[model samples]
Target chain A: MKIGQFEKINDFEWRLPRETQPGMRVPVVVFASERMLNEALQDRSLEQAANAAALPGLRGNVCVMPDVHQGYGFPIGGVAAADYETGVISPGAIGYDINCGVRLLCSTLPLQDVKTAITDFTAALYHACPSGVGGRGIVALKARELKAVCEQGSGWALKNGYATAGDIETTEDSGCMEGADMEAVSSRALERGVDQAGSLGAGNHFIEIDLVAEVFDSAAALAMGIHQGNLALQIHSGSRGFGHQICTDFVQKFQTVARKYQIDLPDRELVCAPLKSPEGQQYLAAMRCAANYAFCNRQLLGHSARMVFERFFPGAHLLNVYDLAHNIGKIESHQFGGEKINVCVHRKGATRAFGPDHPALPARFQKTGQPVLVPGSMGTESWVLAGTAAAMEKSCGSCSHGAGRVLSRTQAKHQIRGDELRSRLMAEGIYVQAGSLGGLAEEAPQAYKDINAVIACIEGAGLGRRIARLTPLAVIKG
Target chain B: MDANRPFSGFAEVPHTADIALDVFAPNLEELFINAAKGLYHILGIRKGTKEVENIHISMVAEDREGLMVSLLNELLFHAANNQAGEFISLEINEYQLEADLLMLEKTGQQKEVKAATFNDLVIVQDAEGFHTRIVFDV
Candidate 1:
């Protein structure tokens, strides 16, 4: 049922009345095209966005990007900000795959070179990088060493000869966010992660070899090292079991403290406590650790891919385009309704798209803005976009993470066969590797809302501007 | 007698098993306990063959949807690692959910824990029997 209180601001924007729900100190907004909106309203995401507005110390409107969908507490593609002092932190908002995100690498080789080695290259990647359900990589760590990874993040990979220095520079937050505490992570989480490093865990995580099918912003693309038909690799993964266990641990443990702190919520999934509370602080600390683990996981995997490329091309050069996290929370200063305030921004299934001149941006891209890497489902078109000033004024510089799931896994499995799907991709000149057909079917191209539509909404809503479009030539699914 | 028996998400005529146990309650505590019982029931853990231990576990997700993915993973870990066949009921009155786990082992030996995926469980809302099913690697 519609909440009856929201005002349709435009074809792509809607605003929730602050008074529509009790405990809601701020309004909530959603950005979606008509098509996306129709699909999103079918689930509980909009209601969850409203519920997020009810959280204490919420400043600015709780915002939902075009890819909004049903999730635990905060809807995936939902963004909210809380007062750092009075606000609360909930692990649900950061997600199980903490820092589950995407990274893009630009290769100098053109389509000629890539296609020549296409099958062999894909097979090499499948062999070099571990993927599929419970996939494991080449490196394994024990207890003490795993702690170092959780604590130091991508730097750990750099020091251990897994990732290079340039790689660290190109990643968001240099692939490590501050405030990670290994002590906050449980032994079980550590155990799960030690063997998971450099691996791609299942469920929508993928490594795609793509060709720059089109470049809309030529100058920007040139600056970022792109040529039409050039080869690029995209890695999509996250903290894996480590992040999962941490989020699971906190969600079940935070309940008592939420009640003790008298935090009111419309759903049990939204349970949270004051940001400075013992429970909240602990979650943040642990969340950072997971986020860092994810950064390292991707870094290690990328390094492995780079090695394979180097071995194959021998003379080819590659450079990291960028790495960005889709799920995370951070303290940032923003102008909310004219007042500059410090708030904790929670982005779940949403990408941070900080515009030009944002102090947090790398000195080089500060003029061009952050590179938002949106990985489409395998056998589809991914995108590269840049943050804009419009986003800075709108949803705290955020955009949709990907083409949101259109069909549930059960439905997808019923609709498609893995072998058929693989054959179809191969017919289109795409090479595909997957651990399970059931998994491949579940993440079939048809299962996701149109990625082009999602990107158009982001552009239409002024959150980000398109730069380049990538079409997968080969894919690795975990 | 049939009505009183706990309805497993599995073992239904249709033979499903995402949500193996469906119990009713007017309060929160009972809902959690029944949920735990439902999980153990699916693993086929029985009474008296094992000892119950206080097992502390937790999970987080971007939202509740992801929570289910993490929660089942923990239960699967215990079942695989510690031979925890059934997780005993406990107080869920607080905002957080808590419980004790019971492990059944023929002898102390290493067990393989194959990770659980979202595909393993099915959840459907129903009045008669909440249908469910799970397939373990072992």
Candidate 2:
């Protein structure tokens, strides 16, 4: 638990041996600079990462991204793969917000065209997408339609006119996950999800209009349809109450299920069941339902942004770039310990970054790689990166998700006034619209780590390569 | 309002992303009730003038911490369902709590409590009363 305790693997990576803990089944690897490692040493995230290594049937090493932070049992930017046939699946590992992810869209409008109208533009965008305490959703589903959404995901949005075929083609897993069972989802979860589709939930969720500041790799940026100085849209949200309730119900049930299976856990939040067990199957089915719902949720949100852009600049096109999930568990095949094995890789605040040669890449990205969208805090520079095969070899094909939090919300609120923060951002030409000022203050840029450093850690470690950089022009928050 | 007694229990515990509370009471029942009030306190709720509706609630859990999570989540779910509250007449016997939660149709809640979590959660008995730390995923 000290900075000196970790053994350096290179200039950008460190490792804690399996012997670090009594029950650890594998070692823990962390990607960070020396300074970033000092910051993590100040918290308990590394301990949680080691605790995660203790999970049953864990495969390979537990990898922690540079933006790692303390979370519930597992660190936020942590990835762990477990043998599918024998590894246990824990809802906690995937996180409470199932499939919480980011979507990037490119617009044809130039930044100068919307400069004077930025305030009205942000307000219109806020109204276009519902958010905040009293915010309702844009789409309400009937019982039958809800079932179809649970089954079809973005395909449902396409049928409902909220998505285009091009958007579907750019989405990960094509915006729909297989093996989701509506019957496994509880009625309460369904009811909660029915009216909340397309809503941007509070706490670290937002819709940001950014200007592509620079491009590190022209080929990758072109493949992603991102041009320098043009406007782009980033929607950060998830399944809302739907996913939270499912995780709650499952994590609670797994407490006893863990007991039934005689699995010992360091923390109750790490409760899990073997992959082949009935309990795991039911939870996976239910988790997939939430994941699909989230996919459709982002699709509708993107639709709303598209309309806003079209209205402002006639004939303006807002095309999908790519969408990827951070908080999720996927069954993937990877080479580990000298062999290719199937494992359930749980990425909590970490993104899937498959290299160019992977079969999962779209034809357009085969020569570049999967685009990794890392949205920085408001008023900071966001990053666009691509997956590297080094990620596949070192960390189960995963990379950092965002500029992770460094301060508590209460501390952040105490640091500055919401109005003052708004004025500061406005002075920088970043138009801001928030449903709640207190909520706004809590997400101040000072609350997060320097994203540039996190990106450097990724590139220096060879896990991901920077493709482009984006600076915010407008922000809508819940 | 308690005309004869002061409201004295529970304090906020700082968490990086979520809301956490440390509740203390003279007994198990009071601890459960204090936990609920602390949750509403964090929500910054403003009660309405409508008549209160008495809601019956009952459940059992394996231990004190389990029961605590169950009780707090029950209130959180009610809040998400748009039912505002001041829960009363709480009783506890061997890890089971029975109470009538007073719910109002209208109340302005400034914050949303997503769900209670079991992360680093614990309930312990001391000479003064019961103590536990609860984290809510906001």
Candidate 3:
């Protein structure tokens, strides 16, 4: 677990061969600059990546993104594919916040037109979008209605008039996963989901208004409806308590299941069952329910945000650019060892950066690529990148999700004052609304790696190409 | 309040993204109580003024680690429902846990913990006491 142990494949790629660890079934391929590689060594992320390599029926290699940080059993910003029929599905590998992802909404309003009204605009959003710990949503659903939301996802929103047809077209999987089973979801998860739709949960989740500072690929930018100097809104949230409970319930159950399957993992958190097993199917069905719940959750949040924008700018419209999941397990076909195979790709803190002409992408993006949203740390520049064909060949069409954390929350809170940070951001012309100053302190920009460097590594590795860069105008956080 | 006594305690541990806690106690029951306190600490919770509500829970798990995760997740479920529990009493025998909790209406909380994870979780008995590190998805 040191920088020297990795065999340098290039400036942006390194390989920890399978021989480095006894139980590993595949090599761990990490995409990072030398500096980022050093950062990965600071935590147990590389070790965790190696641990992930040992999962049964693993295919190709375990790919680690530049933004990786140590997460429970699997490193955040990691991707691993396992054979569909023979491999295993791990809840820990997918993460607790199932389908935690980002959605970018583009607007026609120029930053210059809304610069003076940011404070009120942010306040309006803060009010319209319920946030903070244990904050309820705009409407609480009955158990029966919650089940529909779980099964229908954003389609449920479309039926209820919260989403437009265009929104569904732009969403990944049309905002619904096909195999979600209400029977597989626990009643406890349904109870937790009852009042959580349309909410922006706390802990690294936020709603930000940004100025499209620059466009690198005008064609891709235009395709995504993002114009330079215009404003865009990004929503970062997930399935809320519903997903957490499902993952908790499954990860606990899978411990016994793993033993039953004779799967010996290096860590208990990495417990898993064969993808073909009844236990695996049940977890997949349950996980899909949470994933669909998250899609609907974001759709509702987007609807609320659009209402706020319309109220502020009268005729303004916030159009969906693209919505993609950062944490998910998808059965995808990819070339492995010169043969195409269906594998379950688990992306934790990684986005699916599908290249141009990929059939999964909507027709509008066929000429360009799927838009990959990478939100930087607070007050930093976020990037909208286009997926590249090279990504399919090299990293299983995966890319970094965000500027990963470097400092612990406690360390950040100890080193930075939330009030001072807010004042400083305001002085810099970035309006800020947060639930607690203490919470704000924990998300200080200094706590994360340099986003620009992370983006550079992505481009260098040919995983994604920049389309536009966005600078924050206002931020609302839980 | 007695659960927050001297022989058992918890402290925050450094984790890159999530919050982690190292809890230590002289025995298994104390360890579970201290872990609950650690969760509340990570939440930055303060006691409420409402009348206390008593809750009783009984759970069976595959092992001690499973039992610990079940306990913390139960506490998290209660916290999400607006009732933050203070441990009234806890008993651990084999892989089963039975506990009585005094629940307080959640009044002030500065943070949110998604769930407690079993990542690298192992209860070790050493010369000092029982020690384990629990990582909470934030």
Q: Estimate each model's TM-score.
A: 0.85, 0.97, 0.98
Lowest summed lDDT over 10 consecutive residues: which window, candidate 3 chain B? B1-10
Q: What digit string (tens of lDDT, one per residue) describes model 1 on residues B48-120?
A: 5656555655543443324443555666555434355455655443234455655565232211223333322
Residues A357-454 of candidate 1: C-alpha lDDT, one tens digit per residue: 98887776777788898878778899999999988788988888898876665567788998999999999989998877767887899988888899
Error of 1 at A447 (Å): 0.9
- Native contacts present in candidate 1, fraction: 0.00
lDDT of each: 0.75, 0.88, 0.93
Candidate 3 lDDT, A69-139, residue by residue in tens:
99999999999999998999999999999999999999999888878888898999999999999779876
Residue pairs with backbone atoms closer than 3 Å in model 2 (clashes):
none
Model 3: DockQ score: 0.83
Model 3 interface RMSD, one decimal: 0.8
Please compute the TM-score of chain B alone for each predicted structure, in the order given: 0.47, 0.88, 0.92
- Model 1 chain B poorest 10 in a row by lDDT: B12-21
**Candidate 1 vs candidate 2, DockQ winner:** 2
In candidate 3, how many Å is residue B125 off? Answer: 1.1
Off by over 4 Å in 2: B1-8
Between prediction 1 and prediction 2, the one with superior TM-score is 2
What value does the lDDT take at residue A468 in candidate 1? 95
Candidate 2 - CAPRI tier? Answer: medium
